[model samples]
Target: MRQTFHTSGPVLMGDQTNSQEFHLSLEQITQAPADCTLRYLDFHGTQAKLGVEYSGTAPFTRDGIKLSPAPEQAAPLQASWCVTLLSPSASLAQLQQLMRFFDGQQWTLVAADTLAQRPECTVIRFQIEGDLNFDRARLSCLRVADQLGADLVIQAAATQRVPALAGFDMDSTLIDAEVIDELAKITGIGDQVTAITQATMAGDMDFCESFKRRMALLKGFSEKRLAEIAQELPLKEGAYELLTALRALGCKTALLSGGFTYFAEFLRRERLPLDFTYANELKFAEGALTGEVVEPIIDGDRKRKLLTEIAEKLNISLERVVAMGDGANDIPMLNLGELGIAIHPKPKVRMQAPQAINLFGLDAALYLFGLNDRQIEKLG
Candidate 1:
């Protein structure tokens, strides 16, 4: 997966001897080198009154604004690390402990930069110079983040790139609710259908079989009711902001779902500003659901295929495609994209995907694109 580092936090160092309390201007902090892995600079007189913590090899920021070096002072690019804290209360001590654990390992952690700053979630970039065992480091990061109730994303310097196309899983990833489950509710079989959905999405049962069973329970439901559900589809937090921002960046967006085209089409035409959408078609007869999906189900494999097709059509490399999902069915496309991000995913999805977002709104994905506080603020 394409990896980018976006970080911001107070470098809380318990070691006072090496920790120098010094004041620096925003420009000075911006011009700071990326080679220092753990440097804590107290920001004085800044509007936000926030301290500057640099842990990765990228520009530092407070909130979404970058603390950059002056025009003539930009440093040469080096290794990059992106660390995102999904939990608001994750202490620097936890990170310090992680690095200390790594201290005995092969890789050496160096300087860092802040990317996006929020109270609940923060992203930081770090520079590493060593013959490191990346796989081991990744495992350690996952373990630590899980224990600390946070998320950690690591991208080697070479893999970082801005994506040209992004494919999003619709039902749970983009919208807050599952359309099928909602339809089941209307059919008075909500509990049964919801259980099947959970199992299917958790990879316990075949999605096709589970879907067929669920749809059968919804047989004879009015198409008008489906339309009503579509009208009330609640988008996940930051869905609109992320899509709009992506469109502005000339990034083509596609909604790839195993869910019905009814709601996906509604989102494209009436709500979200997506450029393309591919989903399973629901069969209807005389303005009523026939309790069947069209042939050639848009399952996980199909989702991956569609992602590749969309990337090819846009003339974008798979290395510049970002895929987001929240279910077991999304595993294929999640692995297919250059950056596979699981948003509030199931336990199975969380363990497999390289990156995940659990603590913040969907907009935080923007940080993965290397945007800073200033750029994000301007998006408003």
Candidate 2:
């Protein structure tokens, strides 16, 4: 039994016992392959993916031959790409020559991404068979893939970068407690607020109208307590870095939340380039829950309205904007943008988003613009 592993990570040079480590960058000059994967690598080759044979965890085999990770008796510290020879009957010497041609400088490989795949491709697919960590192994695979003339199909991971607008969901996205629910908590009507919230987000209730209903329940929360809870909200991970990067890129940012303005403004005060923000306002009278909310609350429709309004105000196209959220409330706003990428969205939310980022941190949104690892390092 044999298996092919593709991975991408830090570069390895020479032999492990006495070798140097340096970044091995790759450049793709031609059309990519059908696909590839880094089960053991990061090179996701369209060609490889297209022809892959998965037999319920069985090793990949073609005809009667098993696809070995590496050939037996292969040289140490050597890499080879398995390309179908012009002449299937070509001698091993011809194969070696073909491999040698690609290992030369004409080809460049980075991680698992391949630069070319066709016959003009005198290039070949490279494989490095060795034991290493996932990160290390991924790098080795790409290094070998590039060295052998074939492009690594895997892409370089994104690094954080530039200023871009960030429209937030103040309630759960930016802060913890929903102001409406908290008011309910304070007024001893927590169940009422929560019930309305779930029903509204579940699409079972009309956003604005249901929101008005919740606000009516909080008609008189005190202004002092709004300040109190604002201090207690926890910012999401990498929030600062994400904001700083976006601002650096000259992004027009704002807070688009269903939560109250009370806590949203508190976040903007830390020096974020908050152009404007929108959310429902709790009608306050004294320092306690009023049991009634203000009218014309910012609901789901309001979010979509604000998205269009903001884009026009910034003198930018919706294509230049990126919105993130985890609930159904974000869908309308998301649709108005050029690329609505879901960030750790709900199952339904993820399904609707044209682009989605779930594996990396929320800041991974930076990758959508094609910034490389090195460029991202400069952002911080």
Candidate 3:
């Protein structure tokens, strides 16, 4: 029987001196025919075989037909995406509809693995065959999440899916409340502070300027009260679980925030296993608020730079880094990391981030890394 082999480029088969040219006719392969196995005798007198079961072009055909082993053209590099459903009642119908959309775009699913099987929250990982518009995928996931009362997280498939260093925003991300807003409430300047915060998070005002205005209002505030409030900062849902799991996996964590250093230090010391903490230091004199932060405040730009520095110190590429945040100032670092997650972020952040978790707790972030309940339990 006549057969054909589709090679990407010139390749030396077996020993260089023993290599021989054996060219065959090329046939156009449209759809993968059926379950087939290609067996051949190796130069070393051993049996070599290849299995083809998926609906993709075969690289080599035994029936004088041109075939490819991949979905389409020979791709030396392929991008993968992990689609996780974080709602117990996620609709299969919606998922299938999205899959159909993907198929229409000529994207192929190489494999589908179930990460979580809970009825309330089902997580699935799909290894795709090609590149995709990740931003659009995030939006689609958001729509599905809204429809099914679910939360969706989409991540790029990577050689190192788990980051060695994880950077998180302190307010409304690692913790359930914004420290500044809480302080404002205590000082009876809640309304004014809240307005500034909304503007700052909405990208209407520069974060540093807004911070200065807010801090100015808290002038003469007692340092002891700040410490007391810092100790009472409520942790975000799944914050402890997420950090513990990451620590168990040998990953270093950083609390990078635009919030005050006092609260960030508190979380690092008592709540989470943080290796690094960077935030605005509240300048205090005579045990009272000085109404000014230390020079060169940690703003959005600083946050981005810190992530890069942390990656360099750990000798990891930017792609091996994960950053999470929930405000306008967080856009920089979020975009800098390989996996930038906006957790319950503002409207602008929601639209810009490539991955986000809206419905579930901070623990849902674990699903983006393809971790299921069983795996997480083992870590604990």
Identify the leading candidate in terms of lDDT: 1
**Each model's lDDT:** 0.69, 0.48, 0.68
TM-score of 2: 0.57
- Candidate 2 Cα outliers beyond 4 Å, as residue runs: 1-164, 271-273, 287-295
What is the C-alpha RMSD, rounded to one decimal, of candidate 3?
14.5
Q: For all candidates, what are the clash counts?
A: 23, 53, 11
Give the per-residue Cα lDDT of candidate 2 at 20: 15
Error of 3 at 216 (Å): 0.4
For residue 171, model 3's alpha carbon misses the true position, in angstroms, by 0.6
- Order of quality (TM-score): 1, 3, 2
Write candidate 3's Cα lDDT for 1-380 as tens digits.
Answer: 00112211122344221111112221111222332222110111122112222223333444332222211111122346655555554332434454564576566655444555443455555556656687777787687667645566666776225578889999999998988888889889999999999999989999988989999998888999987987788888888988988999888888899998888988888888888999998988999998876768888999999988988998978877889999999999889877888988898998888787776677777767656567777778
Give me the runs in candidate 3 sitting further than 4 Å from their true place: 1-79
Per-candidate TM equals: 0.79, 0.57, 0.76
lDDT of 1 by residue, 64-176 (tens): 23433312211123655544444444344444554554455545445444554444454555455666565566667778777755567665554455579999999988899
